[model samples]
Target: MFIRTENFSQYVRAYPIVTFLLALNIGIFILTWIPGIGNQLLLFGIGDNFLIANGEYWRLVTPMFLHGGLTHLLFNMFSLFIFGPELEKIAGKARFITIYMLAGLFGDVATYFLQSGDYRHLGASGAIFGVFGAFGALVYYTKHVFPQLKQVILPIIVISVVMTFVGTNINVTAHIAGLITGFLIGLSYFNPKNIVSWRKKR
Candidate 1:
């Protein structure tokens, strides 16, 4: 299910939400590199608990589109590109974006609540973890129809959780919170109709 064989046009045509998200993320990351305003952009876009406390509530959503560096941008975007399309396909455009935004937002909110006021973070890791969590839900509900999904997606979920702790400066709170939020959302938001519809299309 994870293998991507589509060419650029086909991929874009089939997965508009993923395509738009990839473009939006890459575009914002590029904007943050513009010489004079780069640092300023990072300052404003990053999720700073202190700023959020001061009523800059947008920080929760903004950080999902911001990245600390090229590697950070690439990693998150790559994760989205690989895993996002399938979910978007199954969930449809509206539900897909809702899952992503909710997952990312809950992660940032968790960080705001759990971290020091001075804590700051930028990346889509929380949202990406949410995507994985949704995948876990999908596997659980569809195991009878697609038994191999457990074997495929479960290892990814486990490895991702382990890697979250292994990395430095990682926001463990955001990742965990986003993951739980996503799983719960997935369980309630996605019905058998959506899954069966996706299967029919495939």
Candidate 2:
């Protein structure tokens, strides 16, 4: 079942970090729409190998907050809204922040090394895929407790991989990099043994 927010105030109280992220992305999207601002936003997006090699290292972090278009922004934000809150709650504020950022950075690194040409990249897909990877890891670690999740997780992973190949202009390497980074982080942090104890305490 999907996690649905009842109201704006209640949603903010439940998922402050997710709320802030959503707001920030939306705010940036609005800004980019303003006259003469789209070009400014492009300056912050991830450039090709030469620009990054020239010491524009900040591109790794900034691209995660930029988007190529309204559809790009909407899809990534929707994914974040859906998967972010539960992972944030499970991972806690600091750890969740770490996973989100590291995944995006790793994705950028992958793109920098693997991708060629003068193409620019932007969007939060890398971090969003990180959330998916984290969820997959949790389902894997807790398979005994939640056996049905495997059935759901495998298909999603497969479809994502397939889509990555089929879709034009897709950053398949970034998605894979983020997924692997997130999976390792999740495997290390989310202990299945602690789940029982946490549940009992609750």
Candidate 3:
């Protein structure tokens, strides 16, 4: 019964955070094809986000919704589709959304601090990478318990991080920095003790 509840994925399946984020990213990406509308959209952007232009301080948050191109959106959403359900299950709906948005926000901040002078960047990779790092916590103490998961999940994160760097046409600094921040968040806040829920074995 406990296993059933733990793995049911109810919150993620019906939650607004998941739908809202996906819709926002896809909507913005579609708008990018509209010629002048794309330019105006980004005229208020900040950092490397599309639609971030002209000191739109809000772009710090909005950039998470923008992507560099179709491939970028696909890759980020795929990562979300894969791992986010687990995170939402782990933290519940409210906490899950907080972490997702927070991670993206932190990723944006990292970009701003590291880069300067209107250097632009965009994508959900930073946020998804946060989820990637958060899952690292699951592997830390459960390696023996779930050897299969340990084997699969860690490599995904490592390979993703590596690919962000070793691959061509990527923002290595933002990717790496976002990963580092994400991992730290997972390590610091993820508590294995929380998983041991009990309702009186008797």
Instruction: Give Cα-based local distance difference scores for all models.
Output: 0.88, 0.80, 0.68
| lDDT (tens digit, per residue) of candidate 1 on 52-100 | 9999999989998888889888888888999999888887888878888
* TM-score list, all predictions: 0.96, 0.91, 0.80
Off by over 4 Å in 2: 197-202
Please write out the lDDT profile of model 3 over residues 1-202, one tens digit for every residue.
Answer: 1122333366445445766677788888888779999877755442553334345568677777777778888988867766776666665677667667777778787777676655777677777877777777666756776576678888888788778867886666566666666667667666655544311210
What C-alpha lDDT does candidate 1 achieve relative to the native structure?
Answer: 0.88
> Candidate 3, which segments miss by more than 4 Å at Cα?
1-12, 46-55, 197-202
Of candidates 3 and 1, the better by TM-score: 1
What's the distance in Å from true for residue 130, model 2?
A: 0.7
Name the candidate, 1 or 2, with the larger TM-score value.
1
Cα-based RMSD of the predictions, in order? Answer: 1.1, 2.0, 4.8
Look at candidate 2 and tell me the lDDT of residue 177: 90
Clashes of each: 0, 0, 8
Ranking by TM-score: 1, 2, 3
